[model samples]
Target: MRKTAIIVGELKSRYSVGRALQQNERTGYI
Candidate 1:
């Protein structure tokens, strides 16, 4: 359970980062 929680947290964080990067690219922020 602990490992799963960690993995899920990492995945969510990574997904949010990817989304932010994409948004930035679209808005010409990067």
Candidate 2:
């Protein structure tokens, strides 16, 4: 159960990071 929780947290963080990067790229390009 602990391992699953850790994995979920990592995935959520990664997803948020990816989304932020995408937003940054859009602003930078424009």
RMSD of each: 0.4, 2.3
Best by lDDT: 1
Residue 6 of model 1 has an lDDT of 100
State the C-alpha lDDT per candidate.
0.99, 0.94
Stretches of candidate 2 above 4 Å error? none
Candidate 1, residues 1-30: lDDT per residue as tens digits? 999999999999999999999999999998
Give the backbone clash total of model 1: 0
Q: What is the lDDT of candidate 1?
A: 0.99
Show the lowest summed lDDT stretch of 10 residues, model 1.
21-30
